[model samples]
Target: MGWLSMPLSSMHPHSTPKAYLDAQLTYERVIDEPAEAEGEGGPLPSRKGLRVIASSCLRNKVYYAAVAPTTDGVDGPVFAVVCLVRWNPRAKDGYVFAYKDMDETAGPNEAECPERILALLSPTENHSALQWRRRCIRNLARPTAKLEDGMRIRFASPIKFTDGYEGQEFFVRKRGRKTALAISEHGSARYRVTNMARMAFSVVPQTKVHRTVF
Candidate 1:
C-alpha cells in the first residue's frame, strides 16, 4: 500500500515518495529551468514526462511498481503537466473512477489535457497525422471505468478538439495481453510489448511544460 513496500532502492537507489515524483512530473520554469533532466536514479526518470511512475496493487495486499511508462505524451509537441494516480484495480466497485465523480457529467479539463504541437503543420499542410496524434494523447488522459481482461487504457468518451482542428476526436481503446501492451489502432494492426513492469514508450512526443499563474 506504500512505496517502500517494494524493491527499488536496492536496484535503482532513487526511489522517492509519490508526491516527489508528482512534483518532478510537473516541472517549473524558475526552479527547474532547462537543465538536463534527472537520471533514472532520481525519483523521476532520466526522461521526465516521457516516462510515468505507476504502481499496481494486487490481491496479496502488495503494491508493485509499473515499469517506466512509455508514452509520447500521446506524441504531442506541447503539453501541460498533469497527474494520474490510478487506484488499486482490486479495490471495491465504484472506487475505480476515483469514480466519486464518475457519475458527474464534467467536461474534460483543457489545462490538464495534452497539446499537439503544430509548429508549421496545419490542416492544409497535414491533417491526418495531427488528427491521429491528438487521439493518442487524448486517450492517455481519459480513464477507464472498469478494468477488463486484456485492457490497458480506456478513454471514457471521445475528446473533441475545437480550438484548431475541426472534427478532431482523440479516441482510443487499448488491450493488455498478459504482460504485453497489445494496442491496436482500430483493427488495422496491433502493437505488442512485453514486460509491463518496466516499459519505454516512444509513440508520443517528449513532454514540455509551462507554469500557470492564478
Candidate 2:
C-alpha cells in the first residue's frame, strides 16, 4: 500500500530500499570547481552530469543535485537540487518524473538544472564508487557449460598476472566444455584457466554495464 511496501519487482535493479540507497550513495559526486568552471578533471569514476542523493521514503524520494564551487561572494556555493518521487508502486519506469511535476509533460525546473550539474563534476565519490565497482564485478558464474562471451570468470584459486600482478578473474573470449580462451581485465595478455567445470564467473551490474559516465 505504501511506496516502501511495493513489491521487489517494483525496484528491478534493487532488492531492498537499502540496496537502492547504496546505489545512490555509490553514484554521487561533490565537486570543488564552480558550476561554470570548464574542462573536466576528476577520478574516472563518480564523474557524471548529475549527482544524486536518495533517501528511503514512502514515496521513494530521491534528490538530484548540481553544485557550484565556493565563491568569494557571500552566496558561498549554489545548489540546483531537484526532487523526484515514485508514483507507481509496481513499476520502475515511472519513477523518473521530477518530484512534484510528475506529469509527463511537465519538465523539471530548467533554471536550476545547470546549477545542479556542477555538483556532479566532483570525483571524491570515486573512492567509494570504484571500490563498489570492483566489488560488484563479481557474481557466481552459471554452470561452466553455460559460459558465454564477455563473462569474467574467477578461479576457485587465485592466479598471478605476467607482470607479477595477481588476479583471479579473466574475460571469457571463447567457451568450451573443458577449457576456454580468456583475456585479463588489463587486456595485455591472454591465458588459459583450467577446471572450468568447477569455476564461477563475475558479472558487471546491469546498471553499470552500459555506463559511459560517472
Candidate 3:
C-alpha cells in the first residue's frame, strides 16, 4: 500500500520529548535570530532568539508560529519563520517553547518545563479515546459511524497525558442516550464530556463488535 494507505502500525510515532525537540531543532536554528540589522528596516525587532507569535490548540493538535533569523544575506532584513506542530488530545492546551529560554550555564533541567508542556500536548494512546476520535471523524466523512445507547461499538486506544497535575484521557461517547456525539475525559472517577460536533448519535444499535480494535 502507498504511504496514505499504510496502517498506523507502519507509522513511527514520535515517543520522546528529545525526539520531538530534535525534529524542531533544525527549523529552530533557522528562525532564532533577528531578520535584519539595526540600521536596516526590518518589520520585526532584532531579537536574539525565537519569538512565539501564536500557541494554541486546534482540533487535536497544537499549532505554533514563530519568527527566526535567516542565514542568507537578504536585503531588507529577511527572517526565517517557523511553525511547530504536534498532535495532542483535544482537552489539553497548546504550549510554545521559546528558544530564548535555553541557557546551558544556569541550567538544572531547564528544558524540563518545555518538555512537560509537550507531554501535556501529546496525544493519548488509550484505546478508547482513539476509537472514539476515529468514529467521530468517520461519521463526519461518511455519516455512518454513529452509535447509540446499548450499541456495541469498538473503542480504540485513547490518548493519555500526565504532564498536568493529573493524568487524563480523551475519548468519544454517545450523548445522553441520544444520537448526539460527545468527546469526553476520564479523571478521578468522573467523566466530563465536551461537545465536539453538533451531530447526534444515531439511535440505531451498532452491529459491529465492541472489542478493542486498535
Candidate 4:
C-alpha cells in the first residue's frame, strides 16, 4: 500500500495541534535531560534517528505539525502549523493539495485558484514547487472538471521551512467565493489568502565524500 493509505492516526503520533508543534522542543529536552539532571558529562545523542511528525488541519483556524528526534545528531526534523479551510459539508473528507513550479508563470492556462497566484510569488528555487506543481496538475486537471467548492488544497511541500529540520504545511479552503490560508502554529497567529507568489524558495544539494586511512 502507498504511504497515504496509512491511517492519519498511524501517520501521526502527536495528533493534537499543540503536541505536534512542540515535537522539536520535546526532542531537545530529551537530549538535555541527562546532563541537566545529573550534571554528568557525555557525548550528545545522535538526532538522525528521530521521526518526523505530521500536521493536521482543525475545524478552527489552526493546524499542527510534529516530528521526533533522529537517532543521529546529523539531522533534525520539524513540522509547521497552519490553518486550512474547513471540511466541506458537500464533499468527501479529504482536502485539496496544490503545487506549481516557482519559475512557472501563472498564465491563463493554469488553474484558476490560489495556486496560480502562488506560482507567481514562489521564488525560483522553492524546494518542493516543481514536485507540488506536478502533483496538483496531475490530480486536479481534467478535460471537464473544476475544483469543487469547499475542497481543501494542501501544498505538496511544506512551507516556511528554513532547514530540512523545520518546515510548514499550507491548508487552504474555499468558502463561498473567497479562499483563505491559515498558519496553524501556536505563535504569530495569522491567515492570508492562499498566495503562492509570496513564499520563499531554496534548494539543498547532496554531496558524497571519500576517506582514506593508514
> In every candidate, how many clashes are there?
11, 5, 18, 35
The regions of model 3 sitting more than 4 angstroms off are 1-46, 57-156, 161-189, 192-214
Runs in model 2 deviating more than 4 A are 1-145, 161-165, 175-189, 200-214
Candidate 4 overall lDDT versus native: 0.35
Backbone clashes (count) for model 2: 5
Q: Pick by lDDT: which candidate is best?
A: 2
Give the per-residue lDDT digits (tens) of candidate 4, residues 17-49. 334334523453234334444556755643334
| TM-score of model 3 (CA atoms) | 0.24
Q: What is the TM-score of each candidate against the true structure?
A: 0.17, 0.23, 0.24, 0.20
Query: Using TM-score as the measure, what is the rank order of every candidate, best first?
Result: 3, 2, 4, 1
RMSD of each: 22.8, 20.9, 17.0, 22.0
Could you tell me which 10 consecutive residues in candidate 2 have the lowest summed lDDT? 96-105
Q: Summarize candidate 2's per-residue lDDT along 89-173 as a digit string, tens digits.
A: 3345433222332211133322112222433333433344334222322312223446666666665445543233345666666
Q: Pick the candidate with the highest TM-score.
A: 3
Between candidates 3 and 4, which one is better according to lDDT?
4
- Candidate 4, residue 17: CA error in Å? 2.5
Where does model 4 exceed 4 Å of error?
1-26, 29-68, 76-214
Greater TM-score among 1 and 2 belongs to: 2
